[model samples]
Target: MSAELSGTEPNRTEPNGAELNGAQLDLALAELGEGSERWASTTLAARADLLARTGACVAAEAKRWVTAASRAKGLHKSSPLIGEEWLTGPYGVLTSLTALRRTLRAIDGGHSTLASRRFGRAPDGRVTVAVLPLNRYDGLLLHGFRAEAWLRPGVTAAQARDRAGLGQLTPTTNGGVGLVLGAGNISSIAPLDVLYELVAHNRVSILKLNPTFDGLLPVYRAAFAPLIEAGLLRIVTGGADVGGYLAHHPGISHVHITGSAATHDAIVFGGSRTDAPRFTKPISSELGGVSPIIVLPGRWSARDLRYQAEHVATMRLHNGGYNCIAGQVLVLSATWPQKAAFLEAVAVALAAAPTRRAWYPGSDGRMRAARTAYPAARLLPGGRLLVAVADSATPAASWSTDDILTTEYFAPVLGVVELQGSGQAYLDAAVETVNRDFLGTLGANILGLPSSIRRLGPGFEQAMARLRYGTIAINAWTGVGFLSAAAPWGAFPGHTMDNVQSGIGVVHNALLLDDVERTVVRGPFRPFPRSIAHGEWALLPKPPWFVSARSGALTARLLTEFAARPSARKLPRILAAAFRA
Candidate 1:
């Protein structure tokens, strides 16, 4: 019943001989181009109201949204992971919409300040903006969690202050049309990207849906009716032919896509090397890459081992391992005494976790390819998680040199590689390995105890500066950066279309800063009450977003409603539902 195997015909017509398809594309582009100026001239207060309305519309349609997503992913209506669809699908999108609305309202009131507070500065002069705990609500909901965005080096406090409302600094006298190629994996990506283009960049957008999830076209149209009615947005459905036509269209002034690096190259450059570039429009992309998690060498109790083990498992297993920021490799200290115990704990967590359908396209083929490259990989029961260990002295024999290092498995398969060294030496070596050997400059994770972090103090801070990822999470999953609408999310700065690694531009930056290096988020290894590692009681319930949680669907729905309109009366019910999970 997977999408690939399903016999259902595509909701949109194929481009073989469909004249209507070309006409529809032309109409959408023309409307977007014509409406650009009107949308650009709208006042901040008016725009904020529109965004709020859109968020309310999405909140009201939450059930329909999750139902459609669940059916597409081949999950039963009663499945626990139905909440996955709720949280990642509509809930995440609503969060972004609400955040954007708040920013616009602040601008309207002549307070063009970001929700994050300035925390610290890196040695290289990049300022760190703590973007989480946006308000008392966030502090109450997600305790002990913090996220920050590191401004590009050389950006001073004066420049940061002046750049607060960069996106809305000047009205677009003659606005242009933008083409948005939607991502198939996450349902929120398309709508959220469209919001950025229209609200932040001052451009009207034409959103082309990926064929795999074209069924959501109706739902999107309903949710985004305000924009559509304003003639500032249009949604279309088709395959690569449709995408190519829209990309090369004369009306498209700029393009933003969320897909593979190959697709970006094909769009920016020509299909063949000998062919000249067909579309010269400026393009920005967020593509997949091999992400890594570095575990610093440290003394640990059994509590730390089990806690971090589940943490690593959750990072890799979430979303069926289809996330671009999912941890692909585990970098460990070869000399650490507890390395073996930690690995065993991770194995146990992976085995105990629930299994999800390998729903994404080409996942089976990619899994087979990874198995071929690493013959010794251990396939856990039910074939959900693949654990591979690589130990070699020479660089050529090391997993770091294998194609798997650069290749994004996009499945629930994780590779473990141990590097020789201890303390700062191991940390430095690990940083160098990911920076030089890893393929894309997307995101990376670092895990360590407070003592270990302190031991490497200055060295640890320097290591954070050295890593070339767009997002870094210490003792936290980088996915938080992706979900934090206020934080700028993209590849590291300075990538051209010719050699695009992760991507060329950034998005989800509610602050509207133009020059952004990366976002760094940190969380405590163990938060209040009892540590899950110590087998004591936990202060927080298992995250409702986890696929294994039985009450995921109900908890996610309640949480989304609360986010839309916070009510003290709703807290007890939400907490009770979360605890049941």
Candidate 2:
């Protein structure tokens, strides 16, 4: 056990000076923690009312919230960068709200019987729906999948006299105050963690903001004023000492973290001065990983190739290659003859994309390590490497067995490894190799042709089922899974409290708040005259390409407008504007 938490800690003051006294923490919890069972007994209608108010609040404050997040993250306010994040960052929460509203509408229309509804089942066979509401938007976005998967076997027209526990309804069991250790790279994480605690586990949230963006804590507090006003949330800020003290405090009911695996291990297993691995409380974490983006070569036009290449660059360059979901390993299917050309196109795209700041912790050391392993890696001369593939692998790729594949370089280095075999064979082998050999089970991406996908059909399903990681992105990059709240986030097969990599429990969907092992599957077909074609790579910077920043803005605006109101007549105008942009 960790010495910081074990002996001489009970009823004694923590190592760091206290900012929030026990009484303050306790007072916050007593008010926020007492009404779980009571909430469970409340009608779904009442729950919907609360969620609606929360959604309205978010929508009303969307602009300010987004601007604050952009400033805090050091991103330019008007850049496509900020605009893109603004659209997708709070998407999960909004979608969850919509989902909840749909379910409630059905209930009002007499679909309340438990048997008539769907029930969510965990990877371990546990059935639960204990919801802690972060905002009204939480339920609207995630309830669709939950209802499809798990609803009780019976229904009642009048307030479910014998409804199964853990639906949109908040749980009665008060799990006390949880210490939320936020991530430095992304601002949305802290808020998302707060939502999970409130809706999933029925706990009062005590958020410890990562020092990386301590400057923005006041903005966060303001944005989340609803919860603060309810006395359900509190924000604290500091460095290691503050975090260490809070992690060990008895007042903390549970611990939730989103950061490095090293940090996670230090907190849970005890490293450095606290070398005994002693915290006996329940903790959940989503540690970082070297996510793989497998490119299955197949017949395609130059446009298709360009689109995929640019996407690869975007995924790598976004957040300056700091994202946990960033594409790390570029797995090539040897069966495809165009692999060489694809690599070249990727180089051109990377050279054109803007170089971003190398801001993540340990990014410098990790990037250097990657370069050392593959000296041939193009280090951008004046900019970051436009594209970096391991050169000359004589049947035994040096990087295959080294840290490149195992350790998440967490920088702008893109590692390419080629595999020889049929599409299914390569995919099956890669899945097995990655799951068994990789350090993390966070996320994985697959890029392939529709025909190849069809050929791999049942085998593909089998491979997806066998994957041990959390989020699986097929055809598209893994970032899509993170952006789309419709899917759950966490490891594919959630681990026990004893050990967790991608995290112990799922939080994105706002349902089934326990340790969830979720797999997300998606397939995209190329539209006619696809821009991401194989041969037409050079003319990528021209008009009609979505890769351009102008197009991205147009797309975001059009989608936002469409989401406000879906219309067939407006489709032509949106498409025309899309093409022009």
Candidate 3:
């Protein structure tokens, strides 16, 4: 049964392998012998081959994988249904492989096509690309759209090495086993993190499943069997005690987690202050945060406001608001005429949005905590409680940096803070709030119209420069950008050995050891209707038929088809079915 709202302990379950008792810990550590050397000797072509096969295996068994994943998370079978889009979802892994393969061929021939804009080019000439779904509609809307990225050579890599303070590539003297505590909410985060370590930093990782979804280990094991055979990865299961044992185990080298800060402190400082830190090894974590969404006012049509309002609300409503990267803050200019309309649109969206199953153990407690603070908070009468906090106060004093602001609710709670000032003032205040006020730095979002950008002028540029976040999504929700894989995923720029809010380094985009600080940016599109905004895709209860558009699954399918030539004739039927759905 679920816990009560006011007074209930966290639901802790002990699945198999909780203790990390004997052989499990030892075998995983043994696999990590001389880390980078083991990885370096393995050529990128070979590595690509392994990942490609894994993708093929995943696609072949996409239905089984999705069912298992959904079951493990206690989601209805209807949710995240495997189809052409969801199965292939949007990150074109095949395209990424083709790009990587081409880049490798170029490297062999002493020339490269990486500098081309067909991929994407950042302001600094970084080989940046955007990853979206395989569907045509999304393709048309995201005018500057690029596919998922995969390569070791990019202008961004060069910049990261030069100005980003990224240290020299250092090989490990004594390879230590690393633990990857997977987030239960997202199916792809686990595989992506493990891949980063194996390919980039050259580390062997034992993936520890979150208790909420320990039942799917069998499926993941089979799907990732290649990495297992390569001696680069392992997947384990259990609850808190298992995690504790693994964290303290001397065999473990570093640890990477995607959960709450409380979990991090518990592992790092030990559950009790008196006890020693859980692990003496290096630990890097991307804990949850109250990610902000800055809506920059711009040339308006009532259509733009309505579209964006729904877009913003969808981010919070996705996964029943379980994502660590969910948009929590709505930063808007009070002077903007459309602000009120946008808010109303959001409310309407929330009202119409379907309720999701709130199965996580302590969800009630988190929901109540948010509600007690904001009495007038609107609660959707359904499965999960979606708390909406609208703030109109100006002095900033009215905003208390309490649990709602500093801590991540991990529930469906939306907080709107209306800043009364010029465009520049709002940008400056938003940046300051993110830097000084919030406790996390995993992800952030900015919703600005073209007019807003023109109005802010240098102030907008200055604000973008000042904002400290790993994934600073310009106009879309931060969640979409993070999952793109083409974009580097990590802490904002300027983070280093001492400061690590956005995280210690980058993981996705195949950039390991990146020296990225504020990933300042822009997204020209106001709001997208057919987006995986709130985790739900294109107005569907379950994911759309084109599920592959959302990153992991999508990347896997594309790579599979690219590797094994499926008939081109079938492509039309698949596309037709997806869009029609």
Every model's TM-score: 0.92, 0.78, 0.78
1-581 per-residue lDDT for model 3 (tens digits): 11111112223433543545446555566665544346556654565566677666655654566666556545564443232223222233333333333333333343322333234444333444333432343343233333433222344644433321111133233244678988777666777777655544556788888866676677677767777877777787666766766666666778888776666666665544433543457877666677888877655666666666666765776656777777887777777777777877777666665555676668888888877877777665553333444345545665646566776788777777766665777678778876777767777788775555767776675566566666677655666555454456666544432344545556655322243343333443532343343222233211231222233233334434533344556454434333433
- Could you tell me which 10 consecutive residues in candidate 2 have the lowest summed lDDT? 142-151
lDDT of 3 at 495: 44
lDDT for each residue of candidate 1 in 1-581, tens digit (9 for 90 to 100): 22112212233463334443666777777777778878677888888888888888887777788777777777788777677777778877887888778777777777655534665787577787767766666666666567777887788766776677666666554549998999888788888889888777788899988876777777888888888988889888776766777777778889899989888877766564334444567898999798999998788888778878878887887777888888889998877889889989888878777776788899999888888877778788646545555553546345656766888888888888778899898898899888888889999999988778888888899999999999999878888777777778889888877778888788888777666788888766764444445333335565565545678789988878887677889988988888787
lDDT sort, best first: 1, 2, 3
Q: Once superposed on the true structure, which residue ranges of model 1 sit more than 4 Å away at CA?
A: 1-20, 274-278, 385-389, 392-399, 531-541, 547-551, 579-581
What C-alpha lDDT values do all the predictions have? Answer: 0.78, 0.59, 0.56
RMSD of 2: 6.9
Root-mean-square deviation per candidate = 4.4, 6.9, 7.0
lDDT of 1: 0.78
Measured by lDDT, the strongest candidate is 1
Candidate No. with top TM-score: 1
Write candidate 2's Cα lDDT for 1-581 as tens digits: 44333322223232244455445545654555544434445466765666566665555555666666666556675565654555554443455555545445445455532424334443333342323222233232211111122112232212232442234343445567788998887666777777766655667677878877676665666656766765667787656655676677666778899887777767776664353446688888887677878777678678778878876776676766777777777777655678878988787877776554565667778777777777777766324553344433434444456566777777777777666666788888678767765667888887777677778877776776677667776655565555544345665554654455566666555333223344454535343334234222221132221234556555554544444334566666656655554
